[model samples]
Target: MNVTITTIYDELRGFLDDHQVSTNETILEQHSKDESYHTPSLPDIVVFPETPEQVSAIVKVADKYNTPIVPFGIGSSLEGHVIPYDKGISIDFSLMNKVLEVREKDFLVKVQPGVTRNQLNKELKKYGLFFTVDPGADATLGGMAATNASGTTSVKYGVMRDQVRNLEVVLPDGEIMHTGNLAQKSSSGYNLNSLIVGSEGTLGCITELTLRVYGIPEHIAAARAAFPTVDDAVEAVVSILQAGIPIARVELVDEHSITQVNRFSETDYKEKPTLFLEFHGNEQGLNHDIEFTKEIVEDHGCKEVHFEEDNAARNKLWEARHNLAYAYMHLNPGKKHMVTDVCVPITELAGAIKFARKRIEELGLLGGILGHVGDGNYHTSLMIDMDDPEEMKRAAQFNEEIVEYALERGGTCTGEHGVGIGKMKYQQREHGKAFSVMEKIKLALDPNEIMNPNKLVHSKRRSL
Candidate 1:
């Protein structure tokens, strides 16, 4: 480390304890990579901040030294969002994990950034409320909000940007700011909340957040329907959405994914193209919804349909779906995970998925296709040996192909995974001239380009 960098690290100890500030090789190595296929780069130091003030103080020190700062959560992010490429200080948030408040009467909850989705849900259960945005990773809320993540239930509840009511962030210059207020309705000055939510930590470090929650549904019914083909299953989902049935959760799992799930989970799910679905409402209304869903599936030549109302069975069904990616990793040992997701119009979802699958097959790679088809977002989870240049080349090509197809159909390159290093190359193509505006905003918030630099938006002074 240089003299200035050494001085900053030594001064950071004033704000936090020795144990909270780590220069250990192991900790720096751990902060170097996320769950994605991106190569790792070690940081010089890792600082655990217990409060927003501590974060701001740390940022001030880093800014003074002209050093980069990457926010670290649980490291569950799949897009290399937490990787510190500049080899500076990593501001770790794991110590700030606390459910600060539960405003059950107003369906709002305030939490520190490091709290995981599962942890918040466990606390919300007492109030008969639940946080709906589950990216299926038990990810820290800060990481989820940073990526604007969504999962199966997003079709009904909305994505991270929608659920977030407010955020407490530490600006790059060591200033604490709140993006919004407690009141939900605001024709306010500027929508800073939305901007900061998905900036992937390029804008600022999220310290705390107040998010909208939902009451536990009166009734939740889960089901699995096997279709004769992948296209048939996807088309059935489209028909269901068109019919306006409020599905709480609707996920599509291709035959390959099913095979992996069955192999890993040791459950005999039919190894066919299938839709795992759920509904939330009163008993009578939920039954009606289920009947309509069945009719739609049957119309698409569904081979068989099964429903699960029991709590254990229903939880197990969703659990298996959440674990689908892990099953792929289990099946392909000694391989890195390169999962990518894109969202297209509901009308084009079936074709988009078909195109993605075809590309995956032509490349002769082991890949599994699945998605939350209700809102037209899907993922292709691929396992690749990083040492194999050919495999890596094909994976990149497949991602580009799918993203291009989705963009042509009025879709986005990334559904929930933010524009970290993984999706950075597509921002210009996806946003066109408007990306320049984003660059301006990034420059304004982080003039030094210290907060997760080289992420969603590059420093204005830096060329592409």
Candidate 2:
């Protein structure tokens, strides 16, 4: 390594202990990429910081060297959001993990950025509260906030950005700033919390957060409804939501996905297009919702609807849904996993998914369709053999076609997964003139383009 970069290693060691800084090849490889199929790139060094002050110090040093700073938080992101394409300092936040406080009366919790959603929920269980922005993976809260992640429960509980009430962020120039306060609502200055939540580490580094939580519901019921076709299942979601059932989670898993899930989880779920449903409410209310949902699905051509009466069964049902992607990965051992996230208007969802399914068949690719249909968001989890150039090209074409289709309508290229390297090309097409505004924000906040460069917005410092 060059002398200048080598000096950064020494400076980082000075900020923390010697053990906190790593030039080890294994650690560098681990920090190189996330769960995406995007190509991996290594950072020059990885430094573990335990406090916001330490994070600020690391940022200052990165700024001094004009080096890129990619924040690491378990590296569970699927869009290559944390890859360090421009070899520099990677700030690993695993050591900063801690649940600082749980205010049960206030229904809020203060936690360090490294704390995962599962970890926080575990602690909140003692207080009969739960953090609800579950994006399938046990991803670190910091990473989830960076990506504005959402999954099955987003239809009711909302995304990570919604739960976030405050953030302790370290700016590109090493200044510590709080985006919001603990108040229930705010009409103050700009909604910096919203801006930073989905910034994908381009604007600032989140060191700590104050998040909103919900009390455990008195009654919970989960069910799996089988449909003859994917269209029927998606249409049923629209109907259920339009009926105002307050469904906690409604997911559409296609026949192919169910096959993979059954193979991986060893559960006989009747290999067919199905809708995984859940409702949270009082006993009487939940019963009414379930009955109402059953009527709506039957009207839309549901073949069979089965409810999980026990907690174990309910957990297993959701577990299979959450592990659906891994199921694809497991069954197709040699191929990489790439998912297309597109969300459309509720009315347009059925048609959009139909188009995606058609394209998948036309392209002759190996993949499955899954949707958080309650919110009109779905993903096509594709398995591709990277070595096969023709197959890779077809997969790329499929992604582009579906993304363009979503853009042509009022939908986004990415519903939940942030535009990392994977979806960066679609930004201009999706945002039009407003994409320039995003660029200006990136330039203003990160003039040197040091914070998680080459992922989100592209500035003059780097080309997309």
What lDDT is reached at residue 194 by model 1? 93
Q: What are the per-model numbers of colliding residue pairs? A: 0, 0
* TM-score (C-alpha) between model 2 and the true structure: 0.98
lDDT of 1 by residue, 281-317 (tens): 9999999999999999999999899999999999999
Native-referenced Cα lDDT, model 2: 0.91
Kindly report which residue stretches of model 2 are placed more than 4 angstroms away from their true locations once superposed: none
What tens-digit string does per-residue lDDT give for candidate 2 at 1-464?
78988898888877689779998999999999999888899999999999999989999999999999999999989889989988898999999899999999999999999999899999999999999988888999999999999998999999988999999999999999999999999899999999999999999999999999999999999999999887788878878878988999999888888999999999998888899988998999888988898899999898799998589999999999999888999888999998889888877887887888889999999999999888889899999999999999999999999888888889999999989888899888889999999989999889999998888877555675
**Global lDDT of each candidate:** 0.90, 0.91
The positional error of residue 221 in candidate 1, measured at the CA in angstroms, is 0.9
Report the Cα lDDT for candidate 1: 0.90
